[model samples]
Target: MRDADPDLFVAVAHACLLGESPFWHPRERALYWCDIPGHRLQRFEPAGGALAHWDFDTDVASCAPQLDGRLLLAMRDGLWRFDPASGERRLAAKPPYDPAKERFNDGKCDPQGRFWVGTIYEPRDAAAATLHCLTREGLKRKAGGVTVANGLAWSPDGATMYWTDTKAHTIYAFDFEPHAGELSRQRVFAQFAPRAEGQPLDDYGGRPDGAAVDTEGCYWVAMFEGQRVLRLSPAGEVLREVLLPVRCATMPCFGGDDLKTLYITTAREKRPAAELAAQALAGCVLGLRVDVPGLPVNVVHV
Candidate 1:
């Protein structure tokens, strides 16, 4: 119930263009995240204060760790296997949507070791995006009628799945069958009031962007343009809200030795010059200590 203001600190000072998809690698004791608009994958070693980056020719939206110590990346073009050690990349599967209009966005691996990724319809005109599950059987569509598919996470018991559409200001829950990688009984989990037309930016409560789940089964989600992140209970009640120094808080993940450190990524790309000037920490990676730890990341089987 305590506020996050006193515990928060800067974990990294790198100002990313559009930071997203933060993943904590437990074995390596490192944090990995993507700068979507910047078309780069970044790694930060907290112990030594070392930072590394991998520049890509296409937008790298999200990624999940694999059992082979490589990373399964969901890029603008397709699914790829990237070996950090060798600096090599290989195509795994081509994108299911049209490369011109839609591209992969937020994604993560399910408990069953299947990579679940979603697309973002660039036009933002209609809900044309789809979410897909990638496994040994190849890519399969799991859900559709989405605009900006994001906030992908699962419950602690692995029986429920959560997803969000930022443009719609809604979060959804599904009855998940982990063994079969199926999602059913889709329903609204949380719904925020949309910003009124012509309303000032400060008056906006913001919409859902990215998310994570803690050990207590509570959902932690970033509220883009709201300047805050929220911890919501399983039934969709807000338990706590953590204010951030940045307006576009994109995503959050738990890391550090005990997994008690909460790291947040923010966006600076396309932001107004006046807003960026006032918020010096707008695009930096922010962190804070938390009471509950997060679940261990699921490794992709690919």
Candidate 2:
């Protein structure tokens, strides 16, 4: 139940346009995240304070590690196989939708090594976005009716899956068959009060963004523009609220040797100049120490 210290140090570059989809690489002992609008992938080594970035031609929304030390990237153009060592990348699968109207957003590798990626319908008019699973057969649509798809996670036992529609201010749970990589019995897991028209920033609790699950099966999710992260129990009760120093927290991941180090990625894209100036850590990757350890990052079997 500890909140991130207000004075937390920046874990990476202090100015990512829109940081999202952070994950802990157990093998590298580091943290990786995407700067979606910036078209970049970031890697930070906490132990040595080292930082590395790979620029991309399109928006790289999320990434998952592979067994061979390569990365599976969910970019606007397609699913990509990227070799970090050699900086060589190739298209694995083409985008399922038009890249101009929809692009991949939040994503993660399922426990069974399938890459599950969601999309964002940019026009903000309808529920056109959907979640897709990348398996040996190809990209298959798993869920739909989301405008800004995000907050993907799974339970420790691998029996339940979680997803979010940030535009709808709702989080959903599904019966998951881990071995088969299937989802069923979708239902609302949590819902927050939507921001009223003309609501001030301080009055809004924020919509769900990206999330991760702990070893205890609790879900930890970032509330974008809410200035906090909420840890929810399996039944969807809010267990803890960890306040953040910035307003737009996009995602969080657990790192460090014991997986107790919580890393948060924030956003600055299109934020007011006055607000960004006031919040020095507006787009920086922030870190804090948490009490509970998280589940290890799953590798995609490429």
Candidate 3:
């Protein structure tokens, strides 16, 4: 059953082609997100409902806040630091894979300040993607053999890491060592039935896209094509299911002065015309108030 809440509403007016990787800046009290297909980075200040965006020549897949107020962005070409005040970007690392066939997708900073990012293998024929960890030491491939790497998050205690492969309809968890940013004993955390070729939309539980963890250690994940977000318990049990008004919910992050607002980003790129017509707000950012506050945004140290 859907948890109907009056607090849910569209937080941004503009629609994006593919909105992903929403990060709530704690100090700025603002929300930052990426429109990958649109090649833009967006910011929203709820205090005045002001919206700002920066256009990029390449796809900006994900970003994380840095201690120096700059943004660490994972783009099609490489890892970069973007200065919003001056509109300048400095390359930190180049693409580890063939930029033509693979690009960075979902990413976030671990508790120890390392930026962990995963790739999307565009071929869609094989598991050719990999996840990498970036630190001052350099980029290291942490895991591999995946197609669409999404749903990256950590447990509240930072002892477990969660990651998902959207095309496979699987979420994986790993025992984590925060200090070294190491993942071990990776196992299936959750799995959904594959969306059949002629499957009805209402009959399918969407594949995992992007995710976040709350203070209670529950994992909240957006379901692409499922039109909902699922809050899962630590043991992989469903706690709450939030039915969204749109079809392609891409990701969810917690924001607000108290970190109780669940902000979700959706997608419209490549969707059928009939589907888009049915869901007018398919690509807009949506929000709702929640009782549990979320874990604080992890600032990237480097």
Candidate 2 on 221-243: residue-level lDDT in tens?
99998999899999999998888
RMSD of 1: 1.8
Give the least accurate 10-residue stretch of model 3, judged by summed lDDT.
1-10
How does each model score on lDDT? 0.93, 0.90, 0.93
Per-model TM-score versus the true fold: 0.98, 0.97, 0.98
How many Å off is the CA of 125 in candidate 2? 0.5
Write candidate 1's Cα lDDT for 88-119 as tens digits: 99998999989999999999999889999999
Count the clashes in each prediction: 0, 0, 0
Ranking by TM-score: 1, 3, 2
Instruction: Name model 1 segments beyond 4 Å from true.
Output: 1-4
Q: Judged by lDDT against the true structure, how good is candidate 2?
A: 0.90
Clashes counted in candidate 2 amount to 0
